[model samples]
Target chain A: MFEIFSYSFMPRAFLVGNLVAVALGMVLGVYPVYLAIIVSVLAAIGVEKLRVDYKDYAELSLAVILSSALGLMTVLVSLSRSNSSIFSYLFGSISLVTPEDLWVIFPISIFIVGGVLVFYYGFFYLSFNEEEAHMAGIPVKLLNNFFMVMVAITISFSMRIVGGLLVASMLILLVATALRIAKSFRDTIIYSIILGIFSVNSGLFISFYVDLASGGTIILSNIIIFILVVLYQFLRDKIRTKRFHYLTSFRR
Target chain B: MNPAIEICNLSFGYQKNLLLQEVNLTINKGDFVAFIGPNGSGKSTLLKLILNTLKPKKGEIKLLGVPNFRFTDWTKVRYISQKVREFNDSFPATVKELIASNMYHQMGFLKLVTPKLSKRIDQSLEMVGLSKCRNEQIGNLSGGQQQRVFIARTLVKEPEIILLDEPLVGIDQKTQHEIQQILIKLNQKLGTTIVMISHNLESIKGQSNKIFLFKDMDVFNYTAKEFTVHLSKKGEWVVNNSYV
Candidate 1:
């Protein structure tokens, strides 16, 4: 596991050069970050407006907004002069991360975590019932807009690590798996963070050894963990109900 | 001494279709009032207007003597919308956490749940007769139990007035009566004024002190005795003229 770092100076230089080249080539500047924030915020607002009229058709609203966003992206990409290396953003690589990306991600990670900590209960109430949250004086509009901005920024920045295509799974799958076992909100947060850290590190390790796409490997790891957790829960419930024993006896 | 809610010449409507117009109504402190009307009669809209969730196109609504738009003391007033039926049952939350969320306003931001706050949550759950289910997942509860959880959430704040939009719509008769008893207890014992928009007017027939019938873009107010007489007259007419 540790032999790669100890072997040769050539390997170290090649690694550093690749990191710099990929970072500059893939993410370039902060323009995409700003663009992501603006576009996602607009999409969120549009979806909300549509939801008011078609309250029962929430998925329809999401689909409409998503297709519109995809269409806009296609038009912009088509207008661009060059189309090479765009696949890197569509499927990310761990080695592509630069010191600059770390510098941006570090502060943002802190801010997002701190925001969640400070507004934990407020968010809990809002998720439970927006109208009731407003009645409880939670400043629903301000917090909602703020949360949307944070989410946009997170998705944009994370595209460097997990790619835009798989970033949603990174955000959702860990939490979905954690929810299966977590009894409380705090526990769910803790379990999700732990699972996220475990998946990313192990995924990078395995990808390095096996020569696989880092982003896809990470997402695959998350899916595997989710399946394992579901299986464990199914077995636990079966055993608790004495059905597993009965089934075994019948088979015998 | 001031009325719990005061609406004067209030009107709400779209550009072409007016839902409510020139709606003048007053609900006194500690009054148990019910808004009863058929579908599309704007009962829910009236409640929304009072709660400042919607703006009146014409006149004014005052809550606890202050103008509705400027009213910031939200802990004093709680409005439970009909949309409570749309609650996400799969949400990962315990009954305690649900009730504790109501303390967010008073406790301010970035605050931890204190021992006192926990006790208040327990008391609220107890009032709703769900103290034993404090640790249970909210989604695992029955529909009536979940409704009680929403009520416990409202009661945790100890509001001066409670507004509910059809609290008993999907509940069983037993649970409905239990909820009614809770409302009556709150009004009579704690003096918490209640304004509930209910389709089941008979359930609130004897309980509410004032019943407002929403019809034809207007609100017709009636005392309990007067409403009973009016309801009897309508009932007699239907009975006397029935072809069946």
Candidate 2:
């Protein structure tokens, strides 16, 4: 047993490892999933701001960022000369989260959630009508910059959890599912967060039992939920239409 | 009495092309002023300047006796843009929620909504005849009803002056007439000042008290009665006054 578990920091590692695993299993299991959401939201806002400010050069920002990230990644991969595949970095691996990563993720999660709550009204107003928001005397530029910075910080901190490839789907898929049945903006946001929590927990459970990739499982679960929501909406509409036709025919 | 809006020798341009030059105008309190011009004639640009969305190349604009740049009392004035309906149709909000959002700035960030504010929302919705549909999703409403909801949103701010940019663009005739009556009532009964940019001069003939006709990068201000005579003389009346 000692030979199998042999490592330089064995005693400290065992204690920390048990604590970390327990925390990850209990609460932090969903942290990485939420990180994916934060990253995607940041990207969406960045793209929207770019489109608004530089209409002609709207796509240029994403192009530049993607190229720079890719170039740096290539350089790092070449220099490291590691046998490990890049797929883990791109799609994320649950086992890759270190103690240092948790320290970064914890504060960032608080900041992202707190910042969104504080600026919720301003974001809602601006997203609906920018010109009217300006006329209403909301500090449009300041609010916009603050939101962008929050998004950037969130993305930077969260990329390790869900990976760059699957982040957008985690953020948008649950929100889209929530929108189908939500009657109000507040309800939509609440439902999305609820759905997100459900997806992360369920995905983690499935991943552990079935021995599948955690990030991919989470995304697949969200997609499945979204499809179910869509089908429910379709069936409800169909039933309502049928009932309406039946009543009208009987009255006639 | 001082003018509600004062523009002094204002000049605005985009890049190298000048849109308006040496445009001087004054709009008084409780006055309904209609701005009429062809497309690309800077009608919306001038309104944007008054609203301080765009800066003038030279000269100054004063709103309610305060310089546009220095003006901060936004609750006193409301603006409705041409692209008001361009907001995402699928945005999950009811008519009341949409109107209540406009009050958030006034109520301060993160402050709980009070009963007084709730009453105000109900009153504004009632004023726009959308009280019954206050709970309905905004996306489910018709185009005309959506426009009215926006108008109610503006009204909830209790603005003394309302700036409207083509509020009647895509609505049907009956809804258009209803909106015209609503504006007329707001102006006459509540003493609200209205500055509107419109192409439908015929609908505004007897409704608006003043008209600002943009021609050749200059604005010619006239009483509605005076502009009617001027248009008839220039044969421009034939194009716009076909309904009349």
Candidate 3:
């Protein structure tokens, strides 16, 4: 790893890594994952604040955040002049994850899971009706901020394994598929967790044998599951409707 | 006896123009009050201020003898906003789930709903005549049914005081009547103090004991008969700035 300093392009990473280590509590020196969590959480707070300020034009705030983030990434990528590094960040390289990353990831995972469990009803209530939740003593603003922070932490940590571009698939696609089959909120949560774990494990298994990109393979697995679920729901609903009509006509 | 709600010299406005000016008011316990006002008459704003959702530019509000800002017992004071109309109908929760959500403070964190709590939820649903639709998706209900579901959601708390902002809007007359009956029952039987903002004065005429007419950045207290006579005359009185 030290021999890379001889390369012309290595100085940028070395200089910035040292600078970030000095500025962000020396976490960048031992583990860069902490820096990502801090940056993502700051961005989450910024986005959430903008959302509150421009509540009437919420999509506009999201657009601004998205474009600014992409622009910054482009600028950083150009400055570093490293195509491989950008590719790893975009599609994820499992080999790049260090054991030190696990130390940070494990506790954050528990925090996210525990936070969700504790505030489950609050989240559900706030999603349905915010003012009513507030009046009912739900601490709407605090819970919302906590939830955003939790999501930010999850996305940042997940990016190390799932890549930046495909992280949303890890978060949303499984839940979307589960929603189609779930009868209740509890069912949705259970199904999504099962789908998420299954997709990721199977994606890793297939990638090892086929020599495929782990993140892309995982997202592809999710897509396949989602498509199959969609087809299943469509066929089931069609059959139910047909049977209902057949029975009604026969009785008539 | 302390007033259920007390406002003393409260002034509120939006930058340079005052909507409510040094308003002092009181609602005795168990009194069914109606806030009858015109569009942009600051009725909803007054409700928001009373609920402490909006910071008053000046003055104080007391609920059940406790100062508004220091009051932490919010489960005892329920508020149903006009925002119920803007609720996402596609939200995936059943009527029972929605109603049970209000009892979260009672349920404690990370704990499952108990059988007793579930029974209370069923009772609230039954009160709103939605026990049959307990498992139905709240979003799939009719506007009237959704309103009643929200009422059940509020009722589940068994609140001491319920502040409503146009609870009867956009629903059928029958549903509005049903909601009115529920409010009346809550007030008469349980002695729950009711403060509601309504555009339909006729519906609240016999229901509400006292009516507060919001006009010209001031609040005036009136009996039902005085309000009707005043409405007939249409602001032709040359009276003093007396609140009552």
Fraction of true interface contacts that also occur in model 2 = 0.52
lDDT of 2 by residue, A130-213 (tens): 666766666777676666555445444433555445655676677778888799877888999899899988987999899988
- Decide which is better by TM-score, 1 or 2: 2
| Candidate 2 Cα errors over 4 Å, as ranges | A1-53, A83-89, A95-107, A131-135, A148-164, A244-252, B8-24, B37-42, B52-60, B109-116, B215-244
Among these predictions, the greatest lDDT belongs to 3
Candidate 3, B96-183: lDDT as tens digits:
7777777787776673577899999899888878889988877678888888888888887788998998888888888888889988
Candidate 1 — which residues are off by over 4 angstroms? A1-87, A237-252, B7-25, B37-42, B53-61, B67-70, B109-112, B199-206, B211-244
lDDT of 2 at A103: 80
| DockQ versus reference, model 2 | 0.46
C-alpha local distance difference test of each model: 0.74, 0.72, 0.75
Full candidate order by lDDT, most accurate first: 3, 1, 2
Candidate 1 has which clashing residue pairs, if any? none
Q: Is the docking of candidate 2 incorrect, acceptable, medium or high quality?
A: acceptable
Candidate No. with top DockQ: 2
CA shift of A38, model 2, Å: 14
Model 3 C-alpha lDDT versus the unseen true structure: 0.75
lDDT of 1 by residue, A123-202 (tens): 77777777667766777766665665566667667666777667776877887898888876667788999999999899
For every prediction, compared with the true complex, DockQ reads 0.36, 0.46, 0.34
Local lDDT at B106 for model 1: 58
